[model samples]
Structures are given as C-alpha cells and as structure tokens.
Target: MSYRVSVTTIEKFRRYMTEASTFDTEESLLDSIKGFFLGNDKTKFGEAWGKIIEEGHKFKHVSGNLNGYLVDGIFFSEELARPAVEFAAAHPKMIYEVPVAKEYEVNGMTILVSGRTDGIEGNITRDTKCKFRTPDFQEYVDSYQWRFYLDMLNAKTFYYDVFEVQGFDSLVYDKKGIAWLHDINIIPYEPLYCSSYSDMHDDCKLLLRQFFEYIEEKNLYQFLKPYKSNA
Candidate 1:
C-alpha cells in the first residue's frame, strides 16, 4: 500500500516519536499521523501558543488591546505577534502563503508531500516563527520544510523570519499577557547551493522507509486511513 505524506507530517511524526511532548504513545502518534494526512484538526487544537502565533500572522496589529486579545475565546499574546506580521508584510516583492508539492517513491511505497509556505519572493522563500524565547536555530536547520520547498520552487534560499517575544502583563488581570516583539533575521542554516535535490530526495526516501517499517512492525497501518490527494 502507498501513503501520502508531507514535510510537516514527517516532522510531526519525528517530533512525537522522539521528543518529550505530552503525546507519548504510539497510538496517539499514529492518530496524529492520520490527522495530519487527512487534514483533521488534531494538531491545531493540541496547543494554544503555536496556534496563536500562526493566527497572529493573519492581520496587522491594532493600536491597543482595550477589548483584550482573544483567540478561540481565550486571551492570548497578540502583542507578541504584531512585529512578525508587520515585518513579514513589509516585503513588497514577497507573496505570502504559496502552495508547494511533490511525489516520491520510497522502498516500493508512494509518498506525497505537500504544504503551503509562509512567503516567497522571486526565487527566495521565507518562513516566519514567533517565539517567547531565543530560538534554537538548529531546529530550523534540521527541518525538512526548507529543502522540500526550495526544490519545489527551485528557489535560491529559504530564510527563517524568527521573532522574539516577551510578555508584559496588563494592569487589568483579564487583559494581561500582552508581549513585546523583536525581529531576528536568519540566513539559511543549510543552503542548497548546488541544488542537486538528491540530499532531499534521499533523506525523504529514508524517512519514509523507516516510517513504513515502524508501521508494519507495530501493525499501526489501520490508523493511517485512506488519503486522496488534491494534487
């Protein structure tokens, strides 16, 4: 049987499988894999801060939080997100939210990875992240998104538009948790200079091979479900 995968999906699988996050079971991770492949909301609602940061990219900031910033009906750090969106929008040539995709064959199984990027300018691609602390740049360095998107767009470089955020409590309790935003620009940790696209293909093929082996050995295929790609 074949599987549809995404760079994000592989990262999610790897994160849950290796990291010390709350979802610490094979069952939950399988469900997460299924959810991501099927575009279910499992990953979205799991945490609030990440979702808040993502939503913060949607629009420019308003002057004051007089009404209090609410996401999913709960107060969140809207101020922390303002600088990211503002700076992200400042690029005149950059187009936000571009779709990219490709298919691969790994160990006799079909794998399709697809997703939208944060922005692309000419041959340049950029992904934005808003964080409460200084980022471990290695995380971006080790990501699959840049390589995949770079090759898909046949782009020059992928940049991480990381923003640092710090919280400032409001005088009123309910209106608290507003934050200050600092923009940090990053060069590509792994620059695809020659653009062989072989490293990416080989890396993806290996990941799928290992992933499939795990599924087969653990008998978790039942959780993967059927996927029909939009292509």
Candidate 2:
C-alpha cells in the first residue's frame, strides 16, 4: 500500500519514540505519526516567514511594500522588510519552494517521504528561519529535516539563513524616518556537511521500516478520522 508522510511528521515521530517505548514496530510508528498530527502544527510566525522566504527566493524584483501582505496575524516588520527585499533581489536565479519526494519499501509497503526546500542555488539548499534567539549550527547539522533535504535535493551543502527578531516598545524609525518597529538581524552559521551520507541514508530507511511496522500493528487510521472530518 502507498503511505504519504511529511518530514515534519517524521521528526515528531522520532521525538515520540524518545518519550514512549510502545512504538517498537512499524504499525505503532505509523499510528504515532498520525496520532500527533494536531500537536505538530506550525506556529503562525513559522507559517508567515516561510511564505515570505519562499517569495524572496522566487522573485527577482518585488515591487510595493511586503508589510501589506499578512498571513495568520503575522506580518513583516520594517526590520525584516528591507532584508527580505534585498535577499530576493540578490538571488534572482535561485529556485524557490522546490518540492521533493523519496520513496522507500518498508516491509513490502510503499512509504513516500516528502518535503520542500526554501530555496536552492547551485549545489546548496537554503532554509530560512525567523527566530527569536540565535540559531545553533550544530542543531541544524543533526536535524532530520536537514538530512532529508540533503538526500532528496542531492545538495552538496545545507545553509540556514536565520533572522533574529528584536522587538521594541517605542516606535522605531529607519534612516528615512519611516516607522519600523522591529529589528531583524541575520546571524552567522556555516554550511552543514553530510560527511556520512551512506549512514544517514541507511538510518532513514530503518526509521521508515519501523514507522510502517508500528502503523500496521496500531490501526493509525482511527486517529486520522477526526482530522478528516474537520477538513
């Protein structure tokens, strides 16, 4: 049978495995993946900035103000506006929001793993994040998302462009005296390396097998019923 799973869900499943030891088989893993779907939802900031970063990657020139476009009660502040525009203008040729998928056979079942990269230019895949604090490069290096992106995109290097958000109490102004209240600054982090590509690939394959086994044993479809009705 064909099973569809996202990278974020896979990450959550991995986290669940750490807390609960019940998912020892593929059936349980699949159920766990679907069981925690509601809890795995992205934050408003994550959703908003993700779109902005995707647009920046795709457009060569963005006219008008980005602050005009808001999603889920989140908007680009003055601090982020200039940099967002600049990043887009700078990388006109980069591929944005590229969907990628890789399929694996886990215990005779088809498991399709999928994700989308923020941007890709040359041999590097870039992921942008609007963070409240500085990003840890080592964390990214060990991330499942990073590894999956590398394997699926066939990227030589993975780069994270993290924007640190600075909030202000009073009204802030730009050089032109335009009211821009938030300050978004880019932090430094080196590109991550997949030194042991083969090992990572094998690990993912094993995870997929375990995930499917857990699902088969646990009847994961029951948890998905509520979500389907809501949809």
Candidate 3:
C-alpha cells in the first residue's frame, strides 16, 4: 500500500524519524543541543523558534513525511531517484505511520520522546534514513532508538533498513562493543533482534513508564533519586 505522513514530522527529525527524548527539566542543557542542531538553518530555525514562543508553547511544528528521502521536490538525476524508487518497488508490503509515546511532562515541564516511526508492515516495521556521511555502527544503533518505539508498540522483534548513499566510511562500536563498517551498498543484511534485543527494549519501556509516572505525579525528588545515587 502507499503511504504519507505530516510534513512537519518529516521535517523535524530530518536525520531520524524521531528524537531521543524531551528535556528532563526546562533548565536542562538539552535545549542547548537542540539549539545547536536547529542552528543549521538560521533563517528557518529563527522563524520556527519565534513561532513556538509566540504560540505560548502550545503548538510546535512537525512533519509527517518521514519515510521519503530529503531531496528537492524534483528528481534531477535518474541515478538519484533510482534507489528511493527501487526500495518502494521492492518492498511491496504496505507501510504505515505509528504514533508511539515518547514525550512526558515533569513538574509542568514537557518531556516527551524525540522520535517517530516511518511506518509498519505485517511483521517488519521500517524507517527511511538518508545518510550523506557514513554512519558508524553506534550511529546506526542510535538510529533504531528501538527502546522507545518498541516500548510503545509492546513488540518483541523489529526489522530496520538503513539506506545510505556515498560519504560514509567508518564504523561505530555498538554497546555489545562490536564495530562494523560499510564497504558495499548501504543496504546490508537486516539486523536481527533476538530475545536479548527484546529484553533490552522492554527495559527502556519500563524506564520511561516509571519516569512518566513519577513526573505526572510531581515526584521529581523520588524520580531522580536513582540517578543521583548512581552518580
């Protein structure tokens, strides 16, 4: 089946469909990181930020078209559109967009998830990634952000594809501490998520759920107790 998403959602996380998570508190330094990224387009970024402020923080911009590549609305080279079209042509399975919970509020502070899923198939859900530069394995792992999405879906397994075009040359070391690089086409074998992967993803869900509960009830001290002790 064909698919489409909000232009805002599609544009917001131009790199990945979703972000990592919302700020822990309004004073958190995460805003700085956001500023750094959004600063890439000073003109558009300023306009958008001004809108956010003017709207009394009630509304934020988001894009729905997350799956498609971020190319000009026109296809200048058959060489370029070839891959995007090829992917859709090959994956005849119907794709769909799913809204998974990520954002949460802590003491009137909005802390939500920072990511979105491109779409889902019968068993394999998919995300569209356009990487101009090579993505290390850690970068690849980070892209999955499976913990958040899987938690929302309450599923055990998932399959993802990373579509890369020229520029990537290095690999990233995953948490398991393995490093892998891309030497051939970006579309390598699908990463398999065994039971171990499921358990880890489930743990993230539990973490977020507990975090939301604590914040929703105004339990900041108790909510941050664990982190403080660990630190």
Please name the candidate that would achieve the greatest TM-score relative to the true structure: 2
**What is the lDDT of every predicted structure here?**
0.56, 0.59, 0.39
lDDT of 2: 0.59
User: How many backbone clashes can be found in candidate 3?
Assistant: 26
Candidate 3 lands at a TM-score of 0.45
**TM-score of model 2 (CA atoms):** 0.66
- Measured by lDDT, the strongest candidate is 2
lDDT per residue for candidate 2 within 157-187, as digits (tens), equals 7777766555523333456444432454444
The local lDDT score (0 to 100) that residue 155 gets in candidate 2 is 59
Evaluated at residue 46, the lDDT of candidate 2 is 56
25 Cα displacement, candidate 2 (Å): 19
Order by TM-score, highest first = 2, 1, 3
Q: Candidate 3: deviation at residue 218, Å?
A: 16
**Which candidate, 1 or 2, has the higher lDDT?**
2
lDDT string, candidate 1, 63-104, tens digits: 465432344433434444344334534665777677887767
